[model samples]
Target chain A: MLETLNQTTFLHTVVAIGSFTIFTIGLVGVLSKKNLFKIFLSLSIVESSLFLFFIGSHFEVGKAAPIVADGIKLFDGHMVDPVPQAMILTTIVIGVAVLALSLTFVVNYYRLSGNIDIDKMDELGEVQ
Target chain B: MFNFEITALGNMFFGLTVLVFVSLFFVPNKHRSVTLYSLLFASLACIFYASDLITLFIGWEIMGWSSYFLIAKTADKQTLQKYIVFNIGGAFTLLGAIILIYGACGSFVYSELDFSAVPSGQVTAITILLLLTLFVKSGIMPFHYWVVDSYSQSNDLFSAVLSAIISKTGVFAFILIFFQIITVQYLQTPILEVVAWLGVLTSIIATFKAINEDEAKRLLAYSSIAQVGYIVTILSIMGSLSLEAALYHTVIHTFVKLLLFINVAAIIYVSKQHRFSTLGGLLYKYPLNFILLVVGIISLAGMPPLGGFSSKFLIYTALLEEHKGLLLAAVLFSSASAFLYCYKLVYGIYLGQPTNPKTEAYPRIPLRFYVPQILGAVILITLGTIPGVIVPMFNGILGSVGFEPVLYRGVFVLGSDFASFNGGVVIGAFGLIFVLILLFFVRLKNRSVKPKDRLDISYCGEVPRADVNLHYGYGMGRELSRIGLIKMILSRSSHALWQRVSTLFGDLSGITQKLYTLSAQNMGLVIFAFFTILLYMGVK
Candidate 1:
């Protein structure tokens, strides 16, 4: 029984490592990407990794989804921590708000300036 | 309806009422004025009676949005967008902090959150977040980008409200942040120390920039930032002396800045110009505005016995007590720089020879212009003479925040020495002496003194020519803005920081566009590699 538990811990560590590597790939894509739409979608991918890590790290052997049903009781030992989940919900909302706002700014900027390449904007150049 | 414990609720509701009615109705200047006046009263009411963080935040958000709409009426939508975004950033930061605290303690009641009860890390986080929000709203360094851009573009009346009352909400927010939510014991780290240092640096740098600013509104914007920097430094000290010093500054800075901005607004209104090059010799015609602005500038310089001096004196004392050696030096340097800009503001635009060939101005201003100036000027003088009345008031404000209330009347009071006076007594004496001299000159009646036109300043080897556009206001103190330290911190252009951020965004988009260049076989290889890595990780 103890050996199985130890093996489970090592497996969890491996999963964590793999997930982190995927996260790095997504981050690299985000940093290197130049298209407005693609950059935003890359950010979405990054958010997904975070959600997976959060939900996955809380997983335990034989544990089930953290919700109540006919058989599953509230606050059962089989369920994961509720606090991180609630926090992630708030984080998701805030993230969405910020993303929407920034995209709107981008859209409006495109509408006004015609060119979205920030490298091209020199309306107010640095004073010597 | 909920039997609210917050007295500020009624006032906030009243402000919203005005905001609603004004937005719906055509509300010509009279209706606008009445609504603005009522909103002003409502804000003042909110200032007095805010109970908890929730109530305070409500009042605070209301003030910002109302002022935003008011300024939006004047500025283009882009300027309005910048204004709204910056303010919302501040509001949301405050909200995030309050929510965080509430989550920790399961309570929204600010009065119940004892500074000693919370973990130090939580306290630190809360204070830092609150400071960042307030600093931005107050237009402190680094976060001061929105100020000059939006302020210069906003309408005159809305700009006045923005300069005077709207900015004070940040001060109000700071009072709560520093005095109520934070304790010196809790701030074991030197966060407040950093804030103090930043404050001094902000003032010094911004003051240097102000001396060289060309636009009247932009100059006032820089000057306002510098003044607020001083107040922020004093508040961060958290001692009784510093807190009182800050509040005194809050009142005085409001009065002096309001007086200056309104007079400048009047100039823009009358002359229909904003650049100094187009303005000169206003003192010859609008003497009341000239006098009020001159006094206002004098107060701004912290000249003895004026409203400016009283608060500045307290600030110097607070610095002395703390023995903030470098900070003190910065304060003195900024104060000295005040002379360059203040002189330029007074002499270049108002006193110097008019450069315009068409030198005649609109000869006079209406009562609307004069009334605001008088109200602002009177408050400056009154606050300077009897700051004793507000000393307890500051203490009361501090007390509400849960910090130790600063005693205003004690022997340790700053700037009480004759050297750092409000200059009220001396100014009065000077006025009397001037009157007596004028009388003597009148009684002798020997030499006739002709009133010279502003365009008639005697130039080299030439008589005063009517065709000469002397252009007295051009290039006054522009060189003073070249202070390397200030230039480094201040946005180099009107669109400096925002432009960079926007560029970075564009570059990001550009880079993202390149990702689709890969072949379908390469993409399959990537997928194969990914699954192989996953398998390897699981087996390991």
Candidate 2:
């Protein structure tokens, strides 16, 4: 059963379903949570799901890692494309930085206003 | 990365810019910036000399922003907002048209785009967008919502720039785009007719509104709009003669407005008063300035022995050449009524008895003020005497834009084959009559009895108090409001219409605002919902 599930088409289907499910859970958490920290955390979860989708969809059964050391002489069809993985790696770094910056802003906001609930933060005042 | 060309049209515009800017240098202002003004002048030259849409647009934006900063030095928040919003909206519309042109022709250069290859529908759309931009820039009606506020609220000296130089940019662009770029072969006639009607209608309404204005600058502002309206109307005719007519009017109006606005600025500088009611009895106090203003108004009203009449005559004859009888009638009507506001401008500021007790102590006007006024007066008189002198320049412009030059018979005579006038005869006759009247006035001065007091006038057989309001300026144009036709004109306000439009947009934005809640969860939900919809569409 493990060998059967290791097929390339089957693995792609699994990856799609798994990542989409994770994305939905994050979306639900984001839409249902009132705390700013939880919302941002859910956002990070969504971002991770996107990274997994990109990396996993590009994977194949027999493709080697795109390292050109002992046997691999050039970046050819024998190895999987490294562009999406590289892009995802850069995106992950930026995501972490953004998340940290945003969390810092939230912490400052909470310290100043004594509120983390987005609904209760009425700094913009009444809509008129 | 920008291309530039030097055509006769550009030459004329740059010359006007230099003249107006030099004159404005002598105008005293506390908030004036040489850098900002120099930037504006350079940008204007860039626009006039630009051979491509990109360069034109870049220069246009710089001009708008620099002028905005200049006006912001004195204008209130509301006026500044109006000025920026309308002007930016105009710029964006022009950009849209330019983008459309690029999409069709794959180039920004004027000479590279061929209108024959574009579809008629696309051409019409581009024409309309460009016209809207020009209309807003020129302060033509319906799009002229920002004009009065900006012109009046700007600092005194810059008002002349706003009226004289900046407004002409629109007319210049109209000529550039319609006459040169599009080349009229692909033009739709009905649109031109509508433009002509719009022009005449704007003039008629603005004339009435000018008459109704109480503030001096506001009156001149409305008058400026009306004069530009005539130029637009005449231009819509699209004949060599009409183009010449428009150019003539444009030159005359530049000096006319510069003189009038500067004259009013001098008065305000001295008295700290600009309202018609408080300003009076200045004719004797500042006789030279008063005379200059009279010359300015004479040209403004399109009266004989002035450059204004030569242009107006050309406009009427051009209209007759095309047999646009009804339009000509409306234009004539507007021109005739313009005299009322012109008189009010003069009578309110100078002719009547002094309303303020402090008028006796107002200081002598700075000698610098006379520099521009004398230059303007001399130019106006010279143009009036030799109206055909500017014909060669206009003909060069017409030739450059692919039109036959209108007939010119020496510097004294001005007109086309349809009709012509001897400028020399007109000016000489007026001069002779004027000198005779002056001599008669001097002879009569010996026998004329001096009044004991200003209050010596018999007022319904009763002695009026010193504080009695006797100035005619306050009630000069109030009678026009009672007339049924003019009342109809004055009753309709573009301000109210624009307010309704803004409120409608406000209501629309309010609906959009419902989607934007401050709560983070709701925003997330919106994002999620948007993505889900996109996913569903992609799957489908």
Runs off by more than 4 Å, candidate 2: A1-128, B447-456, B503-517, B531-540
Candidate 1 residue-wise lDDT at A69 = 81
First chain TM-score for all predictions: 0.75, 0.93
lDDT of 2 by residue, B226-274 (tens): 9999999999999999999999999999999999999999999999998
Model 1, position B293: C-alpha lDDT score = 92
Can you give the DockQ of every candidate in the order shown? 0.02, 0.40
Candidate 2 clash pair list: none
Best by DockQ: 2
**Error of model 2, residue B274, in angstroms:** 0.6
Task: Kindly give the stretch of ten consecutive residues in candidate 1 chain B with the minimal lDDT sum.
Answer: B1-10
Strongest candidate by TM-score: 2
